[model samples]
Target chain A: MNKKIKTYYLLTAFTIFMFGFSYMLVPIYEVFCEITGLNGKTGSINSTLVIEKPVERFVRVQFTSNVINSAPFKFSPGKKEMVIQPGKIYTTFYTLTNQSNQPLLATANPSITPGKYAEYFKKIECFCFTHQQINANETKELAVQFIVDKKLPSEATSLVLAYTMFDITKQLGYKLEK
Target chain B: MNTDADHLHEDHKTGIMRWITTTNHKDIGTLYLFLSLTMFFVGGAMALIIRAELFQPGLQLVNPDFFNQMTTMHALIMIFGALMPALVGLANWQIPLMIGAPDMALPRLNNWSFWILPFALGMLGSTLFFEGGAPAAGWTLYPPLVLQGGDALPYAIFSIHLLGLSSILGAINIIATILNMRAPGMTLMKMPMFVWTWLITAFLLIAVMPVLAGAVTMLLTDRFFGTSFFTASGGGDPVMFQHIFWFFGHPEVYILILPAFGVISTIIPTFSRKKLFGYDSMVYATASIALLSFIVWAHHMFTVGMPLAGEIFFMMTTMLIAVPTGVKVFNWIATMWKGSMTFETPMLFSLAFIVLFTIGGFSGLMMAITPVDFQYHDTYFIVAHFHYVLVPGSVFAVIAAVYFWLPKWTGKMYDETLGKTHFWLTTIFVNITFFPQHFVGLAGMPRRIPDYAVQFTDFNAISTIGSFGFGIAQILFLYILYKTLKQDVTADNKVWEGAEGLEWTLPSPPPYHSFEEPPKVE
Candidate 1:
């Protein structure tokens, strides 16, 4: 009888430990994700590069775009969509634009889906890659230059680069979209 | 002290007033069973309506809102009104007898628990006629959406609070009775596994009911009091609600199934004509499963952007559960191996339960794989998984329990022919209703939608037809129950040759107040 009671108590202690452990683990994991970016950052993907190459071999493509928000936006084109041979790097003209009504108040939120490719794509000097703001109706353009890796697969064609323009003013509930 | 003849003519008149005001275990058990049966039919009818709506997918029978209400009400009714109450009814009837006590430890509390159910379910069911409608949010009552539901929300929440309170109190009563009121010679280890399982289940209820109460309270406060506890705009996370809900929710699943485990344990031994193999191991396994239940909450939330570490931890823990669960399945099969088995209706249901529940368990394991669950979550696969466990696993055990005990309770034999008919109809139709759901879910059909796209229509039609057939089949159970109550038939004191228990020591249809002096346990 005493043994039964002892076993019961031991089981009770075990159950309590498990319950507490379950509650603690969730927040701990959230912290890990925050520190490691192990699952890739949420809402953190922002650059759109359109490459247009009319002819094959080495071709030059000009990039153009309008920026309506406050952050500086830049685009680089590799070989254009029409002509790009496998294992070749073509000089592509890069364009940068900035349209902001005021200094940016909100930080850039970047995210990626199908979360398998975070290592392959690296971002630098991006308007959304970091926090920056342009003055109201301020339009500025810059060039981004890059070469498509010769080792890049032929099947890696026509990638979609998307940039969502978030309004910091509207986030604060004021109409700033001109 | 007394001879058999003197005992036979002894004044058995416990007056009408005794029944009305009684705290007697047997009386309370009778009331609970009858009430649950009534609720079962009511809930079953609601299911028929849902099936009728999905009969051909284009709103054949009811509007979308009404269809939602039917689905919601059906789940609410089955989980609370029917299955839980029925198990409690069995507990009321058997716990004392099995333990050699005269009644529950806290008898008044038992009555209160039983009586509160009707009012709670009444409040819940009456919401169908309310200005908005019955709770359309699925039984999980996930917020942000449930908050958008109007006046009926409070009624539903109030009903849930009442139900949870009743369950908590019932658990307390069971715990007290098992811990404090066993016969002098009945030690903890010697206590029936049914009693032991319920003891653990009661502990679970006491621990989690408050959490559920707190969760629903937060929901109410958020909706009415402008609390931002779950609002994304006010720095509260919507995902936090899932965390809290599943915290209480996972254990709630065990609360439904543990008693069924008890029932299966009881039936398997009786029919197999053998002592339950590894009784101590069975007890340990039940405890392990209950302990593991707490950590497994996150398995249900793999798609909610849970961190990879959290996902792996939950996945591994959830899978670890199958070890003990597999032990139980193996134990049951071994118990039955080469034993002279009979095909009585109760035994038949129990046999079916062993096979079907294992199938459910495998699917559950399949769902626990985090990557695979990403495809299965919130889809028909999930729907199929639970229904498999719930319908055959829990519901079938409840039926088997009823059949096993009916003769002992009523002192009359149920028509075996009719019972077998009911079993076959239920078994066939239940599979038909839920099996195709797997294919549809794999084909990417999400659950809780009132309508579906045309391509998925065929499987939906087959499932809906099965649902209707299963719904109508339950009327046979009702008829059998009615016939047994009205007819006269004799049952022997030892109801079955293989049956073993203190309850079997008494005359069939035990006296209104049994073991006024507690019986000695061997």
Candidate 2:
């Protein structure tokens, strides 16, 4: 009887452990991504690598900026387009204005197309790497320092660097309405 | 132990109160089975509605959104409500009897587990009445889209949580009972196959039910608590929900079917008048299938854009499942290879299970190739593959089990003629309904859409007619049940000559309280 009761307790404990493990899968997935270069894929790069190397190969890099619908913010690229040599650093500024009364936190998610060029298009320093908090009625200039590595394929002629601004205030526990 | 308090409690066994408060294994088993039957029709009605809408190129019976609800509800009520509870009902009745134990290890918890289901299903059904109607995100309830649903979302999530909790508790009780309450000298290897299959299934429930609960809880938090577990802007990827969900989802597939394997294993040997071929192997194969279920989850997400290596790995593991599953199928065939055979309703169902489930298996294999699945994904082919396995595989086996054991449970034989008639109609219509879905799927009609291109009209009409045929045929089953309850022929203790096991030795319509002192098995 005693042994039977103990087995019940042990099985109950195992059930609880599995419940917690389901939540743990989030971090576990992130770690798996890390091991597999999920964080490295088109995310960030060493600026010194870009500053030290220079190549004569030039690629047309176009910038497109947009914000989520009803996000109450005006956003655009300071320069709509540019052509830069591979392995050469270039800076582009994005202007963001908070059009609402409440201070808002937004994250600019970056995408590059044709998507295969993502690995070569590195963002050495970009406002997109972190969340940007804009005070009410505030305007901000966010700069992106990026380089196309020399390994970019020769046939690739054009790349679009697109940014979509997502309002993250409620998600971050800021307790504020967007 | 027969004190006055016990006697008073025993009196509760007769009236409506008996069902509400009793904890007896057989009574609870009956309750589970009845719930299964009721929910099967309920879910089946939702299926008919889905078919009615999809009967032609344009919407007919319901609007698009409501049509989506029908598909979602049909899957939920069928998988969680109908098939799962039926298996649990079988376990509640058969496990203790097979092992010579008096009852389950935890009776009160067993009662609680059974009771929670009705309320949970009720809450989920009420979601249809919510201001915007029930969740129509399909059963996967993928986020971003699912979050857009109105008042029904929270209710649906809560109902899922309750269902998960109920299954988990039921699993714990089954595990404890199997581990601790076996009759002396029965030995683990000597136990019946149905019991063995359920023992593994219970563990699966324990392992994955919590995971499902956690997944739904995360959905709730993402919806209400402002957590970003599935929100991209909150540094969370919505695809991660799929990963977590299928982690539970794939095993959930096995959880539905493994017991059907047990039921078939139990039925085939009796009707064949032979010992099961490779009994030990059947045990090992079931375990192998369970172990493999965990790693092969990503097969469902092949079209979801996984990394190339991940796709290759998932495809390989998914293909590997065919090996053990093939082992189980071949063993059943070998058991029936050259023995005196009977085509009783149960035996017929089991045979059909082998043939049709293999077809489902073959289609699953077709979808296992990453590139192939990209084409088959979310199409009628996906619907056809799972329905073949689920309807013919799991649902058929449950029907077989009930027929195989009905005489034993009622102390009266059901009308074999009517039984076989029910079997034939069901078999014929089930094929008519699901077979066209394969061609429709390969023809590239996506699922969950209320209407389709006119080019796809013929097959969809045929499928709908088949579904209604299948639907009406079920009424005969209800008639057969009603006749059985009004039984005139009393069944003998050993109902079938080839029957083996402690359950057969016991008198038909086993004592309300049985094996109280435990039978010694050697």
Q: Every model's Cα RMSD, please?
A: 9.2, 3.2
Tens-digit lDDT track of model 2 for B1-522: 557445745566568988898888999999999999999999999999999888888867798889988888889999889999999999999999999988899899999999999999999999999888999998988987898788999899999988988998889889889999999998899999999999999999999989988988998998888778887666677788999999999999999999999999999999999999999999999999999999999898887767789999999999999999999999999999998999999999999999999999999999998998889999999999999999999999999999999999989999999999999999999999999999989999998999899988999899999999999989999999999989689889988889999998889988887777778888
For model 2, the stretches where C-alpha displacement exceeds 4 angstroms are A38-62, A69-74, A80-90, A96-106, A112-125, A129-140, A146-160, A167-178, B1-13
How do the predictions measure up, each by TM-score?
A: 0.77, 0.92
Task: Go through the candidates in order and give each one's C-alpha lDDT.
Answer: 0.75, 0.89
| Candidate 1 stretches greater than 4 Å from native | A1-178, B1-20
True contacts kept of each: 0.00, 0.63
Distance from true location, Cα of B364 in model 1, Å: 1.0
User: lDDT at B438 for candidate 1?
Assistant: 88
Question: Clashes in candidate 2: how many?
Answer: 0
Clashes of each: 16, 0
Query: What is the total number of backbone clashes in candidate 1?
Result: 16
- lDDT score, candidate 1: 0.75
Q: Residues B1-522, candidate 1, lDDT per residue (tens digit)?
A: 345435633543466765556677888888888888899889988877876676675666788888888889999899889988888889999999899987887788788888898899999988999988999988888877888897999899899989988887777788778887888899999988888888999888877776676667777877777565664333334576788788888988888999999899989988898888889999999999999998899898999887678899999999999998888889988888888777888999998998899889999999999998889999988989999999999999999999999899888889899999999999999999999988899888888878777888888889988888887789889899889888887778888879988888988898766776778877
